[model samples]
Target: MWKITYSIVGYDPVEKEWGVATQSKFLAVGAVVPFAVAGVGAVATQSYANTSYGPEGMEHMSSGKSAQETIDLLTSIDEDRALRQVGMIDGQGNAATYTGEKCYDWAGGITGKHYAVQGNILIAGTVEAMAKTFEETEGTLADRLLASLAAGQQAGGDSRGQQSAALLVVKKAGGYGGFSDRFIDLRVDDHKTPVDELIRIHRIHQLYFSKSKKDRIVPIEEQIAETLDHQLTRLGYKKEDQPLLHTFKDYLHTENFEMRAQEDGFIDLDVLEHMTRS
Candidate 1:
């Protein structure tokens, strides 16, 4: 019954995705707080949390319930409902949140068209900051989610301090190898600056997993080839008789940038920048 945290559950209608981003003084807050399903909804349950609320809430939404109906059903049957706080966004962009009366001081939540922001054991204005940022920020769902989390922390985050954070987003056939719904799932299990660390790791994740735009690909022109050759040599690879493209392909494979690699002699612009930085 010691759960204390702040979180946002959001839906991106343009991408048809649902996600949750949360930070807490509690250890591995990601593991306990965020839950999402592609084509279903997302949930964040905290503050003397009932873990069952996550999966159960999704089940209710999947069974044709709205976000408010799902939350109502969950709180109605729980004997200790007054101790729980939860936020949710259904697939249709309906959002709902509930903060039990008995939750710690400065506890409450706000819901909007496609988001629910909530927290407990926090300084005043945390949820308000989160809601404002989410509404004003423009980018991908992950971008908005992370921005909102940072805003919450800046406004006065968990009174107990921050320890761990997590980001979870799901899309149809978005997982690795296109085999699952886990588009992006990252966690900072324990860190002094968990939100910042999470952001750093997410950048790495995007570089390695995100699809490259066709327009960003450039052919290995004379100057670009020389730069690539020089960089590759510094990494301990000697120029060989094989075509420069072959050598570059080998380097891409070794560095796990194969997803961004192109056939012929073209290279993704971001991948090239990463190579030069390395």
Candidate 2:
């Protein structure tokens, strides 16, 4: 009935990003389960699901409220507070989680330094698995958040099974064209294995949108140059007339790897791998 869900809200201090990853036994759970604002916070609202808590919690945190305070304020005025479950992580990485007293059996939550994991109508170890994974997994905020969902599923997730999953992460100037904060917002609205689907799409999303990190950029020479020339010729580019970098740029633009392409005589490692693989 759209009431069974588990989620983790996390903040990555290293990247200054906030994220929410969730899975549920309901259709299109992504639309209602996750929310975040760059330099503000992230929230996951579920259970009987008071949708307003997502925005209201973020709004309160934006005004200098701690994650716990924001949760307190949101649950305070709601007449049906006892039916709601929510987790939040503020910009400073302070986290909090709440499970309403009247929520379904097996509902509860756990919070730590930079993450809050909670669930309703879930198996006993769901939140525990999520918490351990989020703390131990190392990567971008999106990576850790998504791993947490996978771990939760492995530990016996929502009793009724999976239908939808979502992953959302936000950082200042991290979106497409660097004009928005929606760095990664991918969803599996209805799927037999929603978390797996979400992970697959997220890999593609990173390939197409994320910029290359400095450490991963390598000079365009040797085997990389040879490979690029071979791949470009297959695409009908004349490398003799144009420099390898220029020809690679054309290929990057054509393949929608424009965001990860660089002009400093170097190519991102992942982009190079994609070029060779494709």
Candidate 3:
């Protein structure tokens, strides 16, 4: 029996996104909890987790079931329903949760308009703190979700302690190079402070992977070339007859900044900042 103490699964109507953030004393709680699919919904199955709840629950939601309907149908069929705990939020912003009668002390979940928060073997305030944070935080869905997780931790997370943490968020074709919906999938499999570790890992991922704002784009100018040349030279680049502009362009591609750069000679200011900052 797994003991995943806390999780939040929610939908963002503005971005048409779904995400789950979870932390636990159990090793690799990320693997046992979050399950989601783009244009479908998000689910976190915990307590004595029934892994099947993920795929099957998503199947029902994708086929037009409301969040409550999906939860009802799925749990009703589980002979061990009383041993399971689940939280779900569907594509249309409907939310529902079920905490089985037989779940451990402090095991329960609460649903808001477009989100659900749940926990087992947690401090009494953990799940409630998560819900409050999600509602009050600003920025993108990912940012809000992370804030909720942090708040949950601040309010005293899993009573047993911490070991692993994970974050998963999905959007249509939002993955690397637009090939998949997995916009973010990060895990701290083992750590003395998994939440803090996961947050640091996420920042690095965002620097390299997240989309750059259009306003940050700047045309290649002589000053820009000089900046690149100065920074690159410090990093052992030699001034060649080859233009530093082309050299910087090559560097951008090498560093996977293709999404924010155009060989036509315009680049995102963040790229330049990245070059100088790094």
lDDT (CA) for every model shown?
Answer: 0.92, 0.89, 0.86
Ranking by lDDT: 1, 2, 3
TM-scores vs. true structure, each candidate: 0.95, 0.87, 0.88
Error of 1 at 119 (Å): 0.7
lDDT of candidate 2 over 1-278, digit per residue (tens): 33799999998888899999999999898899899999999999998888888888878999999999999998999999899999999989999999889999899999998999999989888999999998899888888888999999999999999999999998899887789999888989999999999999999898887667889998888988888788788768656779878887887887888788776688888987776676
Model 1 misplacement above 4 A: 238-243
The C-alpha RMSD in Å for every predicted model, in order, reads 1.5, 2.7, 2.4
Tens-place lDDT per residue, model 1, 1-278, is 66889999999999999999999999999989999999999999999889999999989999999999999999999999999999999989899999999999899999987999999999999999999999999999999999999999999989989999999999999999999999999999999999999998998899999889988998999888888888778886647677778888888888898789787878887887887787
For TM-score, the strongest prediction is 1
> On a 0 to 1 TM-score scale, where does candidate 3 land against the true structure?
0.88
| Model 1 residue 253 CA deviation in Å | 1.5
Candidate 2 yields a Cα-based lDDT of: 0.89
The segments of candidate 3 whose C-alpha lies over 4 angstroms from its true place after superposition are 219-227, 236-242, 263-266
